[model samples]
Target chain A: MKKVLGVTLGILTAIGGFVDIGDLVTNALVGARFGLHLAWVVIVGVIGICLYAEMCGRVVAMSGRPVFDLIRERLGPRTGLLTLVASFLVTLLTLIAEIGGVALALELASGVHYLLWMPLAAFAVWLVIWRVKFSRLEQVFGLLGLLLVVFAVALFTLGPDWGQLLHQATRPHPIGHENWATYAYYGIALFGAAMTPYEVFFFSSGGVEEKWTRSDLVTARSNVFVGFPLGGLLSLAIMGGAAVLFLPAGIKVETLGQVTLPVAVALGKLGLAIVLIGVFAATFGAALETALSCGYTIAQYRGWQWGKFVRPREASRFHVVIIVCLVLAMLTLLTAVDPVQVTEYSVVFAAMALPLTYLPILIVANDPDYVGEEKNGPVRNAFGLVYLALLTVASAAAIPLMIITKGGQ
Target chain B: MPGESGRVLHAQLHLLDRQLIDQADGHLAGKVDDVELDLDADPPVVTALITGRERITARRIVDITTAVTVSVEDLDLDYYDDWVENHVIAKIPGARHAPE
Candidate 1:
């Protein structure tokens, strides 16, 4: 029974932990504009992340080393340093976006401007990281984040034409005066939102923090296989809600208010309140993950002692890094930039940095010395290689598409 | 150890940039940022592990499996760790204790 409970908890946290500000904004934005025409990208992205995250868990479980450690070891210092800088910048940008997201959620709840709430949200994030146990921190945010499942509830309550939604999902294309460039740009953004690189860094390091061993692989696999797909379903529901409400009405999802409006229309003020809390939990959870990921990547690269499993004094450098990152994020958000815009750019840049993060993981996962008998098999390698190719294409095209579409207009 | 075991290990592949684990507490110390080589020897041997740009003699090495295990007194390779701890994190109220 304890074992079953552990597996269930892992799956629940994984599902809840999956969505973030990027997923929230991008899905609603895409749905508002393109309907479900780009739903196939989400499926492809879910599979990719599951495959990548599974390999990351396996590596950490077997080798007891997190992803960045292996990244430096496999890629060599010069190339690894380049990857580090790129990944760090992207993660930091994501940190800023998440902080902004938390403030926005607060603003939606309290009616104060989001900018007024930025520092408080950031400080709360830092305090949690400083004082909370790793397990407690993860479980609290992850479980609360499940409130986002209200998107599905709202969609069902809205009573949309399921057959038409499926038809749009099956046939992929630009919709309603949208060109292929904008469609493709949003497609990459959605993909990046789904398979954000920080997810891997946080997942692997969390495994190591939880002291997962080879015996825990079953729990890990179930989390990835069950939790993530269900999370993807929630993302689809957000899209469906937007598609049902906003697409036909010629409304674009430009703000967090619009993202929550469909739920309000479908399920009333009670639903809006629930969705606001859900958005708060999701964004706040992501803020913690991105903040820690900044420290994890840098410390692991430098081979410094890191992780909340140890006392803050023990991992002083790591804690300091997190502090510095939070300060920077707070400062960035104070510039009065739109958090939604930051979310869009962060995901696009995440798309650009995908290969830098995943390529080394793929290489190390196949290394016999690191994972020993658990090295990648032919089928895993086949999918791994295919994903690598796709990531490379996405990375190469991300910037150009951003420019051509003028940042998705 | 590689020479003793008659195993040919490439520096880039096996040593450089690998993690250095402190065996005493099983905490990470640093990376094998570079290696000190005995160039005068016929086939140059790795004399020490350079971690955080500081050379720790190979005699402190406890084992070399996937990671280089080193027996060191402080495992804080450089002053940076201490500086950060003392000046920043340790100044915080709950720095010394692990979260309950």
Candidate 2:
């Protein structure tokens, strides 16, 4: 019974842990603009993340080493340092976007400017990282993030034609009005949103943080296999909600309000309020994950003690890095960049950085010295390699696609 | 020690940057930054390993003493060095045949 409960908790956390500001913004944007024509991208993104995350989680569990640690060992100092700098810059940019996301959530809640709340939000994220225990932090935000389920509920409440929605999801083409470049651009964003590098960094590190050994591998698999797919469902629901309400009405999702507008249209102001709370929790919760992940990637690379499991003074360098990242992120937001725009660019950058993060995990997971008896079987290896090739193509094309589409206009 | 039983291992291939886990408890102490080789015999062998932030700093920086003196002075240097020497520098059990 206890084992069952643990597996259930892991799944719940993964579900809540999955959607972030990127997922919310990208899914809604694509849904409103291209309808369900690009829904297949979410499926590809979800599978890609699952394959790599499972590999990373297994590597950590069997080897007792985080992904970045092995990355440095395998790639050597110079090349490893290069990957670190690139991954760190991308993660830091995403952190800035997430902080902006949190402040935006606060603005949606309180009617105050998001910029005014940026410093306070940054400080709050730092305090949680400084003081909270790993399990407590995971449970509180992970479950609270489930409030995003309201989007799915709102979709059903709106009572759209399920057959038509299914037809659009299956058809995979720009409906009469949109062009191929914009459709492809939004497809890349959805993929980027789902398979962000920080998610794997956080997931594998969290597995290590929880001390998941070989015995705990089952739970880890359960979380990825069950929880991540459900989380993908939540993202799809957000897309579906937008497809139903925003696409037909010729609306573009520029603000948090439009992301929740379908909820309001389906379930009135009360449902809107509930959905707003969900959005706030999802974004702020992701803010915490991404901010901590920035520190995790850096400290793990340098072999410093990290994670909320350790006291701050004991892991001074880790805490110091996180504080610095938060301060820098807060400053970045204070430059008055639009949070939504920052969120969009961060996702595109995430798409561009995809191969760097995934390739290392694929290499390490297949390595017998690292994974020991539980290394990737041939079938998993085939899928992982295919995804690696696909990720390389997607990453190479991402920037050009962004420029050509002008970020989906 | 298994580290001594083997022929001279390639530090970069076999040891450098691998996690330094406590043999008894599996607590991750640090990584193998650099190894100390003993040349007192006819053929030199790596006698002890150094694993600490200060050691890492001292190896890379010219003025590590000036930099670490502030933090190191507070530490019982002899005891700290002994602790790192005994506990954190053991050989990885299955890492010997790792392909270069």
Candidate 3:
């Protein structure tokens, strides 16, 4: 029973931590516009992240250093710093978007202006970071994040034709009224959302923060295999919810309100309430993840002491970075820019930032000094190399696609 | 002790720029900024492990007392800038490797 509870908790957190503002917006946007023509991207992205995150966990278990530190080690400082800056900004942008997401969820729940809720939401996130124990923080959010299963519940209750949804997903082409460019653009966005760089950063660093050992590799792997796929399934459920309601009605998902409309349509006020809680926990959890990542990237690159495992004073530099980042993110949100737009650009940047983060992990996973006897087996290396190529293509095409599609129009 | 087992580390590849964790306090003091080697020996010996730290200066940014630095003078990272720029970052156009 203890083992089962551990696996369940790890999976819940992974699934909860999985759907940040990026996944919520991108999957919904794509499903509404393209109607599962790009569902394959979510599947591909899930497998890619599973393969990607597993290596990061492996490296942490072996070397006790997280992926960001490994990024500097494998790539020299100049290149590493370059990678660090790009990934850092992407993470910062994600932090901004997630704060906005939490605020939006609070607004939906309370009917207060999301802008009014922004400061309090950010403060709550900061306080949690400053005081909460690492495991407790993760468990609280992870369990609460499972509240997102309401999306699945709503999708089932909506009584949409499962055959039609699966058929739409299996078909490889865009539906009418949308061009292939827009479809491809959202494909990249959805893929980016599913495999954001912060997830890997949080996973590996969270491993070290929790003091993972060789014995804990199973726990980590279970988190990836069990938790992530379930989270990816939730993303698809959001996509399905959009496909069922918005596509036929010719509605576009441009706001958090629109994203949750299908839930309200299917399950009424109770469903709406439950889904809102899930959104709050998931976004707030991801907000913490991305904010901590901002500190992790800079601190790890500069070799500053970093982690929540140490006393607050011990990792003062890391704490300072986190506080500074949260303030900057809140200021960005204060500009009243649309959080959905932030979510869109952030994920595209995430796709662009992928190769820089993952290449080093793949390279170091094969290094004897790092992984030793636990180095990548042929199956893992094969998947790693394939994802490397795909990531390169996505990174190369992300900007051009954004420009050509006018940010997916 | 890096060379104690008769194991040789490629200077640029392995030794330089790794995080420096101090054994006494076990804080990540800094990174390996430069390694002083005695090539005069038959097998070179790593003589000094150099780590230069940038002073943590608190700047009032947006009314927050935050630590910030813009100088490398405090760091012994002089050798890396030249070598990494020419060999590593310089070789890749735009300092980023993207297949057009």
Top candidate (DockQ): 1
State the lDDT of candidate 2 residue by residue for A111-208, as single tens digits.
99999999999988876776667787887888988888989999999999999899999998887678887777777788889999889988889888
Clashes of each: 0, 0, 0
- lDDT score at residue A406, model 1, on the 0-100 scale: 98
Q: What DockQ does model 3 achieve?
A: 0.14
- Model 1 chain A weakest 10-residue run by lDDT: A330-339
Q: What is the DockQ for all candidates, taken in turn?
A: 0.84, 0.11, 0.14
Tens digits of per-residue lDDT, candidate 1, A216-301, equal 99998999999999999989999999999999998989998998888899889899999999899999999999999999999999
When sorted by TM-score, best at the front, the candidate numbers are 1, 3, 2
**Which residue runs does candidate 1 get wrong by more than 4 Å?**
B2-7, B39-43, B74-76
Candidate 3: what is its chain A TM-score?
Answer: 0.98
Superior by TM-score: candidate 2 or candidate 3: 3
Rank the models by DockQ, top first.
Answer: 1, 3, 2
Residue A46 lDDT in candidate 1:
100
Please report, in order, the local distance difference test score of every candidate based on alpha carbons.
0.91, 0.77, 0.82
Instruction: For residues A263-363, write the lDDT of model 3, one tens digit per residue.
Output: 89999999888889989998999999998999899889887778887655556567677878999999999999999899999999999999999999999
| Regions of candidate 3 where Cα sits further than 4 Å from its true position | B1-7, B53-100
TM-score of 3: 0.89
Docking quality of model 1: it rates as high
| Candidate 1 to truth, TM | 0.98
